[model samples]
Target chain A: MDIKDIMKPENMVYSKTPVLTSTTMHYCPGCSHGTVHKLIAEVIEEMGIQEKTIGISPVGCAVFAYNYVDIDWQQAAHGRAPALATATKRLHPEKYVFTYQGDGDLASIGTAEIMHACNRGENIVVIFINNGIYGMTGGQMAPTTLIGMKTATSPYGRDPKLHGMPLKITNLIAQLDGTCYVTRQAVHNAAAARKTKRAIRKAFENSALGKGTSFVEVVSTCNSGWKLSPVAANEWMVENMFPEYPMGDLKDR
Target chain B: MAEKILMKGNEAIAHAAIRCGCDGYFGYPITPQSEIMETLMEEQPWETTGMVVLQAESETSSINMLYGGASCGKKVMTSSSSPGLSLMCEGLSYLAGAELPCLVVNVVRGGPGLGTIQPGQGDYFQACKGGGHGDYRMIVLAPASAQEMYDFVDLSFELAFKYRNPAMILSDGVIGQMMEKVELRPMKPRWTNEEIIKSMPWATTGKTPDRKQNVITSLALDAAVHERLNHTLIAKYKQMEDEEVRFESVQCEDAEHVIVAYGCMARICESTIEMARKEGIKLGLLRPITLFPFPKKEINRLVPHLKSMMSVELSTGQMLEDVQLAVNGRIPVNFFGRLGGIVPSPEEVLEAFKNSINK
Candidate 1:
């Protein structure tokens, strides 16, 4: 088949799933948020939970998760998406609720909320995007920034002596008895993307089964913040970020 | 039949919340207001009525948990003291922005930081004005007595659900720690799950393909859209002021001195009014029940007849500003308050009223 024919509307197999819409995403060219969003959308579609899913959008770069995910969406306060998700799930115990948060939101200001929610065994899903630096705020040092990661706020590289160690949310939440599933996955390559999708699905499934809190920490790339081309950013994330963050389940039940 | 039972103000509020069919109770233990959580925890309304009760790790978690429940169209609540309430401000703002119906009880103590765990009305401005951010207001109900504490829980829930806004019962340490005779009402569910879901179509439960997708967001990126949203919120606030403004006037119809007070201070002001009446001084009291709506019309009406108005509070003259605005310089407004847990007595208030009248 010709390339033109493959791109034609008649030849294309369009998904009629309620979870994914045709809306154009606002992500940067090399941003991994789109891929993560798509995977979440696909999972909601596959599970036939489009009409029974509620998503909480965080404050950072992915603050617009509501626009992409064709489900009931609520915009949470900065670093309060976990709390919002906890509220949404408890109120509608029959419905599936999840939150999409970034490193700055989840690991920093929102730490108390997420930790307590997990500790209380709140039946909800939390999708934490850990990109090491603050994306929307112009590459500031995040709580999850690597030891030598240099950003606007940590120009001389993140010093453990000065700024504390990088937070491993998956490991932290895994220790909590309330969390039934905890995983850290990357979305740098196609293989990693598939595993990240699986992690997202498992997180939602765990919540659906009333298995308490399920947390997925996705190691994503911020090309604009990293000051790299789309391809190079993915390569850099795979080489420098993934080994430190790791890609595996910390806890599963 | 208006039967009375002795109860602590916090306990009264807890009983009232359970009676009002509050579906979820999320809170962390805090001084003075801890009884509210203790009552719920011991009562275990969840076992009987399927209420979801969770003792959160912190005030921040509790408020957020309330946020989650509210988003699902559930009648949820959280109670805390001054310092704990401060931590919940961010979540409170989100609840208000999302227009979620929830009850937040702040049994206020003295504060700027962790000031004291004693009774004080320091949070008057925080509760009446926007506590968090954005142009938003909470339906602030000030309960002056144990009876009102019990009654106001239902009122707060009704107002919260009716307005699609967060409602707060602003009590104080005096009320929370003190016990009084309160009439308990039969428990009745105000709304079924179906009714609640039907009432809040905008709530983020889930979306079906057959219906238009609903987004509950505070963000309006465009300047024009943002302004329009703010305008809509302002209109709602105006409507609340018009329709829900509540206050109680005692002997104000034929008095020379009017005392403007609310919450615990208002209760004390009532006694002062009685004492002044016995002493042959023409004195009356104006007790605001809804602090945000503020009973401005009542204050304006009383201003023409008043020789002087003394605003009494448990804090350093916060509500006095509102009283001044209401009087609009038509009458002299004086302020009397005891900050950091020193509640002004009726004698002190009477003395202040006497001084204001002499001036």
Candidate 2:
């Protein structure tokens, strides 16, 4: 077969989702953000909800998530995305409203908003990206940072008595009666990406069904902030992060 | 005509919000303004008018909720007291920076820091000046009566959407707690989604193929772009100052001394003017209805006809500074106030006025 014929539409096995803007992503090479962004865009496109989805971007690294996602977006102040989503979903019950938040934004600065919003059962999806460190502000220790993990602020490793334990906010959210679907997934590999995409689609469906808040926590990687090669960061996340976070559905009611 | 009903100022706010076709009311409970949310919850507008009334966990959450609704081109509002309003400053700055239209009612109490629940105009500077960070101005309306409280909700929403800027009703504890006969406006219908999408092209009603995706944000990474945003906001504020200045002048046409006040203080100044008239002292009162657009031109107009100007407030010379700025040393500007939640009596104001004239 000719190369041109091989590159034709019928022969194509995969294509980029049109739900994403043509603008280049700012995520570093091997960063899980790009993969997660791709999954969200793909799911929105696949479901034909590109015109019905409103995204709330957080104040952390994914603050520019609005720039990459070709949807109507509202950039909230720090951890206030859930609060913003709550009102957006309440005011526009017919629309699909979701928030994309980083660990520092969701677990640290915005803990109150996240907890109350979940408790209220706002009927919105919360896409929590947990990378175990603050990626945007030069890898500072995050709420999800392991007890012995080292970062810019925790140079001597995180101590329980000093810095406290890693916050498993996803598990806490799963315990909330208001959350109808709560799952923790990853997008480090092709299989994992497929699994995460399925989880995202289910969460979006749950929102439309008016089941309540659907939380999908993506255990991601921050290669640049982790100060490791992209491949090494994935390895580190799999070996270190997966053990603590663990994959699979915590709650699916 | 809608019949008059005796209502508390805070309750009037709730009734007016529903009647004005507000799409949502997100607020936290606070003194002098708790009646707003309580009344909302009791009325259950969600069943009738479909107005979403939610009591948020905090003032921070409620203000951000308003930001959410307003971004979708909804007529949303929130009410709080001095301390609660203080907590909302960050959200207010974000709303202004994003240039989203919404209404905020602050039934102000005394405060430098959790001061008192009594009436005080100490927040005059905070409201008329920037309450939060950045160079931004909100359309501020001061309501002296329960009627004005009911009336300003619609007016505030109108100006808010007109300018795509935040509008505030800067009421105090006195007006909020006081009961007066208020003539309610007929109920207005809430807009449909299609109406919003058509009227507000910049709203985040999700992406459509025909138009560009709307992004509601206050973040500007580029320094030059941020500066341009700032310039745009300043120009909008300049336009508001030119076209939105609102005030009421009483007896200033033939007077030697003019008293300048706003909100509840203006009501008390009416009595002061009456007392001065009996004593053969021609005292006039210039009440500023819009605190931000600030009747500066009116104050300037009174400058030539007065021997001296007295700024009466519930704070220590906050609005007095603006009056002085308007006068610009053309005549003497005097200040009289009772601090820490004291609403000075008319006799007290009369003595202060007499002292100012004697000085």
Candidate 3:
């Protein structure tokens, strides 16, 4: 058989989801945001809800998530995505609503909004990307920065007494009665990406069932912020990030 | 004629909003204005008219909630007092930059920092001037009576959607808490989902197959694009200035002096004008209904007929600056105000007007 003849539809194993637009992502090389964005687009496409999904983008690296995802989007102020999502979901109950936020956006300035939204049991999905550093405004210490981790702001390495401990926010979210599903996953490899995708799909499904807030915290890698190569970043996340944020479902109701 | 019913100013707003077919209301409780939401909760518009009413966690959340609801091309509104309105300035700027239409009601109370809960017009500058950090403007309506409070809700939303800008009802605690007989309008049906989708093509309802995805954001990274947006906004403001100036001229046909005022002070000036005319003072009142597109033209038109002018406000001469600018040294304009939530009586205003004439 010729090579041209072998390239047939039956030979096709996988393809890109059309839910994502042709806009080139602005994330740094080896960044996990692209992987997470791809997984969300795939999940939206698979569930056939692209026309009815509204995504709220935060003020971090994924602020342009709206550009890549071909869906209705609203960019919220720093730390106010949950409040926006709460209103959007309440007003349009038939539509699927989700918020994509970073560690700094959710854990620092917007703690009150997140805590109240989750407590109110809003029927929305929250996709939290925990990279342990602020990537958009240059590398700075995030609330989730690991102890002894070094960033531009934490040049002396993060000290527990000075910078406080890394916040395991997913664990706290799991305890909220409003949350029906809370999980922590990663995308360092193909297996991990597949697991994260499954978790995302379930979160969307829970939204359809009118279940209270579905939260998925993705333990992500920021190579540029971490000052590491792409391959080394993945290895470093597995060795360091995974130990602090274990890969499993904390609450699945 | 519509039947008249007595109600508080804040309660009249709640009734007017429902009658105007508003889609949602997100607000936090504040002094003298909590009755707006209290009435909505008591009425249960959610069960009857399908209106979504939610008490947000804070004013920050409430204003952002209005941003979200308005982004979907829905009729939404919020109400707050001075301190709460201060907290909402950031969100207000975002709403204006995004060009979203919604209604905001500020029942003014005394304020420098958590000032008295009594009636005061201290927020005149904040409302007509820049309350947020941007070069944007909101259509401000100052209502002196409960009837105007009831009537301005529909007008504000109509103007808001027409211009694609935010609108504010600048009232004081005296107007918000007082009781008066207001003629209520009939209930207008709420817009259906299909109606909203058709009317608001730019709304972020969804990314349907027939149209492009709608993105609501105030962020533009490119300098040229932001500048163009600013130019467009400026043009819209100019249009408002030309077309939306509203004021009431009370007995100004043949007068020697005019009293410039708005909101509750305008009402007080009515009494002052009565007292002054009885004493052969020849004083007439010019009440600005629209504070942003102020009655500057009317003030100038009456300048040749007047020898002097005076500005009466609950604050210490915030609106006086605008009056001075309008007069432009043509007339000797004076300001009379009482601070710290003390409302000047008609006698005090009449005495001040006489003092200006002597000067």
The residue-level lDDT of candidate 1 at B11 comes to 95
**Consecutive 10-residue window with the lowest summed lDDT within model 1 chain B:** B189-198
Q: After superposition, how far is residue A121 of candidate 2 from its true place, in Å?
A: 0.7
Model 1 lDDT per residue over B1-359, tens place: 76788989999988898887988888889898999989888898877777877777788878877777787778899999988988888888877877788999999999889898888899988898887888899899998889899999989988998988899999999988889999988788746766865878776657876577778777788999888878887887999999999999999999898888888888888899999999999999999999988899999888888788888988888999999998988878898989879887899989987876676
For A79-194, candidate 1 gives per-residue lDDT tens digits of 87777777667667888888899999998988888888888788999998989989988899998888988999999999999999988877888999999999988887789899
Q: Model 3, range B1-359, lDDT digits (tens) per residue?
A: 88999999999999999999999999999997999999999999999888899999999999988888888899999999999999888888988998999999999999889999998899988888879998999999999899999999999999999888999999999999989999999888888889989998888898999888899998889999999989988998899999999999998978899999898888889999999888887889999999998888899899988998899999988989989999999989998998787888999999988887886
Candidate 2 on A1-253: residue-level lDDT in tens?
7888779888789889889888998888988998999899999999999999999999988999988989999999989999999999999999999999999999999999999999999899999999999999899999999888889999998899999989999999999999999999998899999999999999999999999999999999998988899899999999999999999999998
lDDT for each residue of candidate 2 in B198-295, tens digit (9 for 90 to 100) = 99999999899999889999999999999999999999999999999999989999999999998899999999999999999999999999999988
- Top candidate (TM-score): 2
C-alpha lDDT of all candidate models, in order:
0.86, 0.94, 0.92
Q: In terms of docking quality, how is candidate 3 classified?
A: high
Give stretches of model 3 more than 4 Å off: A1-4
List where candidate 1 sits over 4 angstroms from the true fold.
Answer: A1-18
| Candidate order (DockQ) | 2, 3, 1
The alpha-carbon deviation from the true structure for residue A26 of candidate 1, after best TM-score superposition, in angstroms, is 0.5
At residue A128, candidate 3 shows an lDDT of 96
- Alpha carbon lDDT of residue B353, candidate 3? 84
TM-score of each: 0.95, 0.99, 0.98
Instruction: Please report the interface RMSD of model 2 to 1 decimal.
Output: 0.5
**By DockQ, is 1 or 3 better?**
3
